[model samples]
Target: MAKLLEIRWHGRAGQGAKTAALVLAEAAISAGRYAQAFPEYGPERMGAPMQAFNRISDEPITVHSHVTNPSIVVILDPTLIAATNVKAGVPADGIYLVNTTMGPCEMRKRLGLTDSPAKVYTLDATQISMDTIGRAMPNTPMMGALVGATGLLELDQLIADTREKLGRKLRPEIVEKNIEAIRRAFQEVAS
Candidate 1:
């Protein structure tokens, strides 16, 4: 049977959570995996918490539906924890990736997680993006961290996919800088 992986993203409207899901799906597809990416938008307000979903399988995905039980949960905005129940559908053995200055223990505490044994990794991807990409857009960098955490795709594959997806819309300098941000996040924040 082909392996299936689902990812759920939780974040505020302007935090690039939807873009992260789309970019990750594109990268997975570029790596020859079957991938589906879509967002669940509620109130179209900037600070409102929203969600996006992705499903990847070695075989073609036939279910074009929202993820109910995700193998991985990515939180783009830490503040969403106050407004959303992000950890509800997460599997016990799955991974949780969050963008925050708080470490894993602090995040777990903040999430009110006590009995769950899910592995959690926290990164200051916002700061990383600000310092490297000169913007708070963390979609690509968080994607890099996901790749490193899951080993779902290779570094070259992500770089190539990123170059293919973003290189045309951005100047060469911007493209290179984003690529560098991805690499740095992969190495630094992917624990």
Candidate 2:
């Protein structure tokens, strides 16, 4: 059987974790892969801890449980590293993609991954979003960084899906700003 790629996203409720997962799954499906994206929410309030998951495979996915062993784990907020066991359920060689100003080596130390085989990647997605969208929403930029790091989906395909998804609710300029954020973060992610 083919190995399905599982991704787990961690962030607060107001962040764009859910949106990022959904967008990635949409883009993968558009690329002719089978994909699933879903969110797990706690209490109904902003700032609450939340999670979103994605499973992508060439063949159909069969597992329906929460992603306990994600091959890729994305942390939308660096603070979660201290506040929660962001490393839970990850394999020794799993990828940790975090949104932060720290360098990958420093982040690896902070995460106690100095001797681990896991790859650590970091980017200031908040700064990227603020610079591009005039807001601190890190979802789009983190998604862009994820694609840039993993090449799970083509960059253009992800952007096109993001544009089509956000265009329904935001102004043309705002949507363009988000696209710019995605593109910029794709270039700026540090592994």
Candidate 3:
């Protein structure tokens, strides 16, 4: 990437938004890109709204504040659409990858992006995770959807990095299933 890329992720508290940000940063670093990831939350409990941010560039990252204007915005919970301003800080040319049963056209309308230049992509990431990982975590699958939308990272490498990170805390079978979720989302996302 010639310029810095900022990505903001929105999800419920227990949905792995923070984990996804960390994995995305680690995966980018493994690819020789400079990156940073962090989460923003208060005393929110499970299923509460939360956000995570990522900054990625070929060169070193300097800005340490929250991502106010993101080039990419990812929403891991479809229900957040009704309660959150998911488009906040997104630029006119920004991209949105949403976890939903809706297609891009429907998502565009839902997000009020019909006349905006921003691009929209959609996927039933929850279903993908449930089917592959036997859970509802959408983070890893959303990471793959992000890759599918932008070609930002090598899919196999991201999966490898995710596996390595998840392997530290998860069982081998669960890790493999998450990897499957990622691959499935990458292929199934509607652009």
Measured by TM-score, the strongest candidate is 3
Clashes of 2: 0
lDDT string, candidate 2, 1-191, tens digits: 13699999999989989999999999999999999999996675888788999999999887888888888999999888888888898999999999999999999999999999999999999999999999899999999999999988899999999999889888989999999999999999998
Worst 10 residues of 3 by lDDT: 1-10
| RMSD (CA, angstroms), candidate 3 | 0.8
For candidate 3, lDDT tens digit of each residue in 1-191? Answer: 64899999999999999999999999999999999999997998999999999999999888888899998999999889999998887889899999998989999999999989999999999999989988789999999999988899999889999999999999999999999999998998887
List runs of model 3 lying over 4 Å from the truth: none
Report the number of clashing residue pairs per model.
0, 0, 0
Q: Which ranges in model 2 have alpha carbons more than 4 Å from their true place?
A: none
Question: Which should have the higher lDDT, number 1 or number 3?
Answer: 3
Clashing pairs in 1: none
- In candidate 3, the residue pairs with backbone N, CA or C atoms under 3 Å apart (3 or more residues apart, or in different chains) clash, namely none
Q: Which stretches of candidate 1 lie over 4 Å from their true place?
A: none
Give residue 2's error in model 3 in angstroms.
4.0
Query: Local error of candidate 2 at 172, Å?
Result: 1.5
